[model samples]
Target chain A: MTRSPFTNPYVLILPGFLLSAFIILWPLFQLGNISLSEVNRFGQIRGFAGFENYLAVFNDPDFYGALWRTLIWTFGIVIGSIGTALPIAIVLHEDFYGRGLARVIIMLPWAVSLTMTAIVWRWALSGESGMLNSALMGLGLIDTNIQWLAQSSTAFPMQILIGILVTVPFTVTIFLGGLSSIPDDLYEAARLEGANPFQLFARITLPLIRPFLNIAIVLNTIYVFNSFPIIWATTQGGPANSTDILVTYLYKLGFRFGKLGEASALSIMMFALLLFFTLIYVVLAMRGEKE
Target chain B: MKRTWLLSVAGAALLSLNATAQADTLRVTVAEYSSKTGPYFEEAATAFEAANPETDVQIEVVPWDVLLQKLTTDISGGANADLSIIGTRWLIDFVDQGIAAPFDSYMSDEFNDRFFPTFLSPSVMDDKTYGLPIAASARAMYYNKDLFEQAGISQVPNTWEDLAAAAEKIAALGDDVYGYGMQGKEIETDVYFYYAFWAYGGNLIDADGTSGLDSEAGYQAAKLYKSMIDGGLTQPGVTSNTREDVQNLFKRGKVGMMITAPFLSSQIATEAPELSYGVAAIPEGPSGARGTYGVTDSMIMFENSEVKETAWKFLDMLFEAEWRSKFTGGEGFLPVNKAVAAEPAFADNADLKAFAAVLPDARFAPVIPGWEEIAAATSDALQTIYLGDGEVEATLDGAAEKIDRILGN
Candidate 1:
């Protein structure tokens, strides 16, 4: 059929494409430019120095340490949120009293800023006068107050828990949307076939929510990988930079030390890593559905 | 319709040009020291605008923690204010990058004579004044009097040996009371260690221009703090407490003694009026050496600021004795203006007198390019040692090596 110019795909998408290019691609172009140059602390370009900044990132021991911690932090938070949120979404989906209030309560944390939540958690977890230690002591859980943010051992795990906590509300919202989309008939048909409760969940509910779970996984991975405030507000990736993930370490190198060239390089590297994981995950997810 | 839009755009442009030609907006980025900082500056700006009708002053208040990052991002984007408040230690980097404009031409002889020499000296780099000290403070030991009496401590400890004994006695009078409130976290963690390091006769940089972190003073200082932590004389969680946290404990009367800036006095005044505390010189170490940290946050002009003269006028007004007295008195900062320091509001204050008593021994942060990184490195090393995760000797040596490498650059 002869198409109108208005209906042409390229013509329809041109404005949007240009807007996004101006918004994202321009700063990206600048970042790439800075990455390849010998830049001064104020991000003023001094001269061209190809690959030197990237080489510096590869050589630093702190970069490697942060890279490893970043992997753990991302996986721990993403998986923990999903693992916790799925059951929560399932519970909320079922017919129950006060489900409306329950949903609102679950969604409340999402409304507060992450920085405020983190700051509140910091005070709650303080060593001497923390609410947590007092509660623990009142319950006789331990003889003495624990220094929660003293070092990596307790601090990293507590940070991951807080990260998981903040990520759950968003994850649960996605899950609830997926759960509601599944028709009641699907569960009934399986139930009439004499499937047990766990069997019915495995057979009907799991597959129905697969796509939403996939979306949740990819988005949460991208978000948790770059999250800053939870670690920053609590420990500032410290007790000797022991809790530093790539983002916190990136901040220190870029803002704290004013190493713009290396910071830009690290930013580009982190972007590539997230992009690679997302693409690979989507491919694997689509292939699994096909099979 | 298109013609109408074009005419409107043109009219708006002329309106803006008319506004700019009438008044210049002199923007200043201020670091928020306390809740009172913003209102104080806003009041100052209103007074400034009232007198200098051609200038409309804008004050952007940034918190202390994010001030540098904000300034860096602002500078990189060419969106920085005409003036900013920066830590004097960070002045070298600003000068090296040519981001800070020299105020030499702007400073008249009388203007130069206003500030105390000690406070003014840190901002003088390469013999050109790059900044003016806007707020100054020095560290001193604050002890809880009741706790000292209960522990039956007759005199405040003047030496390390005596201080350790006093700490033991205070710890013995325990009901969750700590003898020493040592800070092992966040900003100034390294400086907290330096009190003893300086007292034990160490330099931040050795005579040969290398880091002195691995020297006898360094080893002895770390050993002393670690021993106290092990001996349960300091706070329970050494590495968990920040300077503010320790200060909070002191205000709560849980900490027997802590070393901090003079601002803690103002904090205690309003928060705990009956805390029964006294400020004294930071205890000396062996060899009769003692030191306290002297910090000055300086007001600087940016190199790219289009409104330099008006900005200088504001600076001159700010440095005047009347304005300086109000600011210094309100913010609890030591007065950098000599005339303000002589005012009874500052001169007659007992807690301030204790802080001022040690001004001769005040060691400002070394003016170097990589000072932040060096401080971070030293702080990280100290935290590691404090946590008992790394051996003291090895950690200090490793940190010293790292600092020397940075210095070498």
Candidate 2:
């Protein structure tokens, strides 16, 4: 038997690996270079600044506020969506009337453009003329309107809720795929052994879908951490920069304020933070599987 | 052999592109102000092309919000158009970077005389003209006439005290109706605050080149707005409503008064024609000092452009009285051209006259390198004050320190 050269793993993977490396590493390198240099407003690098940009980012009080909010934004949306989507996926997995329609409806929001959805939500959440206020008033929920986006106390929470709302569609799809891959025979055998519904979920469904669940969490954390439109389209991180997450803050720093050097530094730091979190999660999940 | 064929094909494409470049194509990046803006420029380009048979005018319309970002990327890539419409406030940065070329050599005395100096001078730096004012506007107070009549206030408020009184009366009328529409979010939030800041005799920059926000004028102006917000004179949730949100309330007759740009008048014209509203001067403070915010968008020639002469001719055609008047009227801009200002459509317009009346007191955003950062700092402080999260004096003082740092004072 003659072995083909292309059958070797290194030979098979080399081109694909290089293509992905160029696609990803080139911008990462540019960002790192810009972060270490004195970049003008037009992104033209002037001279080496030797970590000055990162130092400025560290010194800014607004950057600290944004960093803190970014954590809350990422966790609040990721946890909330995963929690909501799990039950939803389990329910849809069961045979029910209009099941196909339910699946389509569940996935519908993912089809709409995020920015368009956010803009519509902005109008609906208005203080005076908003449909939300009118609906709440009609239901006798409150005597007066709630200015939802007026203060960070209210606005940030509302923004988190919006993030979770938009994030559920994608998370649920992942869960559904995981649920379908779990053999029905395993659940039937668990029931034959007189396992309860909760036991079935815990032993059969939970263990089987653990990998997908972890993947959903890691991806959602990254997406929600960097989500811009929900907060930007609504409040623009205003009312005193109170609701700014890192991405929105980075945008204002780079584009609005034209502090490209600091923005690049902040971007690199955010990328590192996301990378660290994902790496820890993946390694822990892999170790758990190994054990 | 294949590589040679590919190289020849690439060379032929490049040669063809160069030949087309010599065909006198003048590219202009226009900022879209309204739905009408693109068509207006396209029409002007068509006319310019007809007049100069050798020249082909290309219009690339960009939205106002992303114009600067687009220009920055385009410039960094060396792919910018020959001309672009930019905020006059941004001209200082462009000039400092040598991105924009001075048009002084292109401007004859008569050509220079065509523009109102108040409109044109904002784009001038270091004794050179860097931009031509393509659109100009100033802010004025718009009041609901029916609300004033219902409140039994027949006269326009010329001072803050009178405005407060009128607002109080108007607020007493109903629960849903708000007396004053104050914008505390998004673009121009600081400028909205500056209406009172300047009224209280504040200068954006003091003689020592420090920010004037920590002075008595700043405290008083902030106090006035805080009091209005606290007393329920403004709409509930002052920090939530953007300029457009407040303007929407005004159009619906829910807001008694709003201070906004001349564009709002045109917005009201089409959106709420039946709503009887009157434009008036922004009310003054106790010292009787008053000012209105003047904003201009300028058409500038890029320093990198190879077709400056053709771009200048297209600009000359754009600034001609007929086109200028048409553009001004269609977009509800205050005319930048002297002849366009004399046209009956603008001269006979009462709302524009009120905006024109404040020409002497019009304060363009000061030309500084970090003006955007300074504006952001001011806006954040104002928002804090409006939300009652921080004391007015302390917030303004903190903002002043921040701005001074940006100014390198």
Candidate 3:
């Protein structure tokens, strides 16, 4: 009584399914449960609290502000990085001198740890004695130094800028890979048919790389949506909660404030938002694939 | 051969059991000292183990910022240490959660009386002591003598007006030098605000347990800070500077005054010996009263500690006169024990004496649940005010309302 491999596809995927269930589903279920109940500081579940946690989150102005900021942070970084990366990737895709070295240099920010990048950028952008301030002052661009991370008006923009800077390298690599995967014969045929560079790009290049572009946008959106260390290390979502995004606020609620139930509700909200974006992306990708 | 091997295996197991039965190991965790090796905890452990040869003391040092998270994780995972040093404010939370054991049974009244009542109050809830204060610190004004001389100020400022005048004089010296370095960021933001708020006779909570930041003193404190920033007595972009950044500015002789703790004295001694400075009680406010913030850390025993007696013995050893003096002196912290306070090592030091003078006047933040969130709210309000985002009165009022809500009022 030997069993064939096709006897059960579920069994074939059993290990991966279990791993995902343990790593992802269990904590998520626990989070959902905790979100719906009242929890004390010691992680004890105190009876069910209905939709109280969710109501508290919805009623809180900070949560609303953070949700808006989280959207701005996510889209700003995702679009900024990919938009910048496409040009750099196109440039890098050319047969130029020192292309390998250039590629590595551009990818260095992605290689370095996010925390290190944040700390370095923090020092560089510091108010009184930062390198950026010093350079700006020396260059006579401004008479006074700007407190980049300290002022609300500047902090969020600076965070987004730093987020894009660190995000661009990886995005560039993805775009470069996508560019490389496009058959050069198509471009050669287009050029022979007297198609200009714009036509070559609009028709052959983009269509061919549509799958990679979808992946780049969707993954970047998710990554930037959940980014924490950069914002936490830089501002801790402050100057007045001006730079706070959803994840940092969730951390403050859960760990700092010990409002685990509310924090869990916020986490579920963030999860749903990201999930919504992911579903839309998946559907669009599938439709494009069918076409 | 199999029987012989089995007998040898059993003999080995018995030998291991005998080894385990010989000595008891008490695990302890302490907040990190300035040094990476945590010499204070190491020395205490060595001395404790020396006294009790039959017991082994295993000590772990964790940084203050991560201590609570680590302890909570350990407690949840059922791997907590026998004893650990925690912030005094956290004592109530730990006791309420049943994570910390009441020390009243292990401690005598005389032993408990050894600590200053102000320092010991936070460790007690409902008249049951749960921890013992090991180290304490209070904020004080530090002035750069060189800058003071350059500004032609002969004495440390005694009143808030005089301090402002001195700041003006210091700023008059020009060349990128500022008079006062305000900490407008992070943890110290609200603390700096409190220093002024208390100086002006403001309180966070009133006798009736209501938000007190809407009082006149609160408005005065905010106005004073705003005036200092707007009058050009403080550096541009003061809102960007943290306590450490401001201290560094003072150390570089670029700033004239800062209100910080005794820790800065040692930092200056090590980092900027060339800079001459003097420590004084913070300037009196318009109310003619001086006040500063104080913070304390306590050593607490866990409820589930298996070696409770051994752990208490080790803690008792740490509180002995000689060991207590050594620990406090080594860490540059104010002593919790009165006898340790009278020791020549602390009394003879100029900086320590200055801080000690203000010890009685120092006030601790209210030890209650949700105080962290309250502090953060206050810090946010202060930051907003400092950055000129909102009116001082409006900001303070908004913060008070928010805090009242947080306090469930």
What lDDT tens digits, residue by residue, belong to model 2 across residues B13-61?
9989878755688899999999999999999988888888778888999
TM-score of chain B in each prediction? 0.96, 0.96, 0.93
Lowest-lDDT window of 10 residues in candidate 2 chain B? B17-26
**Residue-level lDDT tens digits of model 3 in A116-214:** 999888889888789988998999999887878878688888889999999998888788889999989999998999999999989987888788888
Model 1 Cα lDDT, one tens digit per residue, B232-340 = 9999888889999999999999889899999999999899998999999998988999999999999999999999999999998999999898889889999898898
TM-scores of the candidates are 0.97, 0.97, 0.94
Residue pairs of candidate 2 with colliding backbone atoms: none
Q: What's the distance in Å from true for residue A177, model 3?
A: 2.2
**Residue A43 deviation, candidate 1, in Å?**
1.2
Q: Write the per-residue lDDT of candidate 3 for residues B1-409, one digit (tens) a residue.
A: 9999999999999989867765678898888867833877777788777878888788888887678777866875688899999888777778878889988888977787677787888788888888888888998999999899988999899988899999999999995899988988787688898888888998889887878898999999899989999999997777778888898899888999999989898788888998999999998887687788888888899999888988888877788778878777767788888888887777789998898889888888787788888989999999889888999999999999998988888
> Residue A234 of model 3: what lDDT?
81
Cα miss at B180, model 3 (Å)?
1.4
Q: Which lDDT value does model 2 have at B27?
A: 92
Residue B93 of model 1: what lDDT? 85
- List ranges where model 2 is wrong by over 4 Å: A1-8, B1-22
Error of 1 at B60 (Å): 0.8
Weakest ten-residue segment in model 3 chain B by summed lDDT: B33-42
